[model samples]
Target: MATPAAASDWIRYWDEASSDYYYHRPATGETSWEQPDRWICGEGYDSSEDSARRSRAGSSLPLEDEDDVDAPEEDLFVVRASLSGPPPLPAGGPPPLSLGAPPPLPVAAAEPSSAQREERRRRVLGEILSTERTYVAALQTLEKVYMVPMRMVADAGAKVAIFSHADLDTVFLNLDVLLKLHARFLERLEQEEASGHFGAILSGAAKDIKGCYTRYISNYAQAEAHISALASKAPDKHRYLEVCKSHPDAGGLDVRSFLIQPIQRVPRYRLLLEELLAHTEPGHPDEADLREALARIREVAAFINEETRVLEKSLVRQGRAFVREGELTKVFLFSDLLVYGVPTGRGYVQKGQIPLGEGTRVERLPRTEHLTHGFAVVDGHGKGYTWHGESEAETGEWFEEVQRAVAILAMVARKTALEHFTAAKAGCTLIKFNHRDGRSSPRWVRISADGSAICWGDTKSKECKSMMALSKAVALMHGAKSAAFYRAQGAKKDRDWLCFSLLFRGRTLDFAATTAEGLFTWYLALAALVGPRSSEPILDEEALRARVAEMI
Candidate 1:
């Protein structure tokens, strides 16, 4: 073989220059053409070497490196690399070995010329791949947040652009995509940096990214604020609380005996105010009343915020203990049906009077006199019995106290049921209903305009607050059913019965208020309209199906 110097010098010339090489410069730069501006190749340049290099410039095309079969892939970059200047013929080194570079006219030359160029092209491809991956990843993250979870789109087809978790990625992707485009535009900008149009592409992309990001954050903040407002509605929920949170003591307390006129007026009025506000256009000058109502809501919210904390705590404590005969098996455990004969210590009884607790400490299961009005007979702890009160039950302090005390029990029971059911995903959410009497039953039910969702008529009771929760829990779990709520009339007052029409029915518009009698009339009318459940439904379906079957 020729001396190594000859071969090395030959290849080095092309490896460093070729226009083809720069075009493919992977990430870093690489060269091609065997000509040489040996500014980089130092220490020994003979007169011949300089003369050879000068000839190697892009002009008098002498395809140097390719002649060597061992040439590297750098020929790719060299084709693109810009080049200029004289070819360098080395000094009295070894004989020239043509690595495509012009050899010393039969002088010793060896070695491949394209080694460095190959390295350069590899680097450039890597850069492109990396940038593409980063951009795509950001786009995917954004899509996940805005499209998948929120909005009713999953239930209905089509997704809306809104903030969820992945919305951030969308914002990032916009910026990234813009930058990539900008970069592409600027590559042509290098030569004409001073030209007015040089970086127009990049500037445009930058602006696009900025606008999209701002819009995203703006929408995200608004959505988060709305959700926060809903959570903050807790205090306002108290405006409907009709029961006295704490009972009036026998001394300084002057309990109101009649319906809480203010309570009824406020919540209903607030609803009206909401409607009025809803009607007001944002910029309208005729919005003074709306504005005042909004101010009231704010103030009311603040006041409710303080009171709810105290009530919530008391509610929790009340939910834990119960007063009953024998050992407490499941105190405060509210369920639609209590499985009789649960095996517990102190021996339990399914019937007759039984003490709620030990010693003179007792509670008899009072008999409920009326089915329309639910109650359990608890008379001095022997064998407990059940009693149903009538629509004509007595009113007064005793009635109220007894009812309120029973309601306290109901509240605890409701809390127990709500906790247990919700945790189990049982679904019927027991929200407390607004009731006028603290001493009356704690009103709780699932209502609809037809009272058809749970019941057919309103049945006010001194007992509903306690029994209604269970009625609803059972109805929801089993199917639709409704229980009437009758206003408690101390044995002295005439019984006020609720009508079916007044009771809300499932899915009907609850825009009208009907009395107990009116509600009953409506239900009778509805029953008449539908004929009767005992009669076959959809006579046409049965006849049509029979005809089709006969034809088949």
Candidate 2:
């Protein structure tokens, strides 16, 4: 046994039973089988004294002098075991050791070093290459077993009863293109991997990858629909597909299953690249390119998702309408949004979108001297927009669709609001709000857990500074802003727009939130306490208080 070298954190100990050397860090209570590099065996102490002590103890192990060792500093501390008991433990004693196996390292002490991170990055990159190869093989299987055979049969001028040439084109639309695109992509990835430049290859092929996948995914719905139709309507095609599943290359999957591979491939690439990027160091050469390639693939995947959402939405109506005098626009009424766009040579350029929600309003307007077939749409903020159509029937159709959409949206919103109110009433909801004075920091306001009272306090304080009984609160004036208030505070109208007031005991308390969602949650929780009159008659300060008091 030997004492730790001076100024070194590592303590070297000889285990007599196993005839092995072990190192321990007293501060972290970590034990390691490997000798720490910082331990200089005989630097701060007399080497001759140490050797004499070991000799007196009947130890046969030889201690190497620092001058005799020609090894580097990292290799200076070599493990030599002596048949001696363990070294004396420090003040509280060393952590218990089994000596049969190394102790589990503490999580805080086990952070991966730079070398470990680099190794992990290499492993993740290898995964990306391997998965891409497999994906390309799947695409090839689709083409060779399903696509090419159908085309060859059609070309032979035989009676193509299972599928028509037109059907083949629709079902296999752009799949060949996708196969070729991924095959080339896989080739490039392989070459880059071989060259030790795996991450740099994706940025160069982003354009082709995006374009091919975008085309393929957008038409994926039509292909799926065609397959579904054939499975139901044509038994012969179904039997043919059942037989195609038996092909060795088909891997026991039908045409539809193989068709879905291209759709899944882009997202797979995104996930693999994300994993690799996570392990890559910030300043590593491949970091920027990995990020860029990930962004491109993510963009393509997002486009496909948006297209899917649009396809799911039923188009209520779309036609030409005039928003202002001589400002004609193409308006599309979807299930949830009113999209107005300017018509271009190729298509429409989207100009704006109005979300249809609980507060939306649609009404018919009387014909004016300058405008005919008129209707008006009022948004959630009480702002009105007028649109005119060429004929009265067109205007009527638009008005009906807008009203139906608004009604449906309001119904859904009420259901959701009720659910939120129920939850807020059952449990505590906390929201932080900034004062309109702009000097005080934000404060945390919360409904009591029992749902009996509302309280306000500093952010970190455990106890509330002020409390008011929920039963005494008379009104919740939401969006209670005025021109005079903005002028007095020297603030813009949109600033603190989610401001509200709670009236209790003929006194008003003002609060404002940075986000609309926070305001809505507070409003719902308070409304659940005080009843529906909390939201009635959003008016000026004086009038709102009077109205709320009257309702009470």
lDDT, candidate 2, at 432: 29
Report how far residue 25 has shifted in candidate 2, in Å: 6.0
What would the per-residue lDDT of candidate 2 be over residues 1-552, giving only the tens digit for each residue?
233454336545544444445666655667665546543232222244655755774644342222211222122222224434223323443332323233334243334457766777777777677666666777787787788777876676656445678878888988778777777878887777855566678776666788777887777667765565454367677677667666766644566656655655565567667877777777888788888899999998798667656655523211111121123377756445787889799988878867777488998988879887888899988888888888888778778767766664553332122234434443332332223333223445666543446665434433343556665566666654533234334333553445666776544555665544455556644543453223343232222222323332
lDDT of 1 by residue, 172-260 (tens): 22433433443453454344333322123323433443344334323322332232222124333122111221222111111111111
lDDT of each: 0.27, 0.57
- Cα lDDT for residue 14, candidate 1: 29
| Angstrom error at residue 367, model 2 | 56
RMSD of candidate 2 to the truth, in angstroms, is 23.7
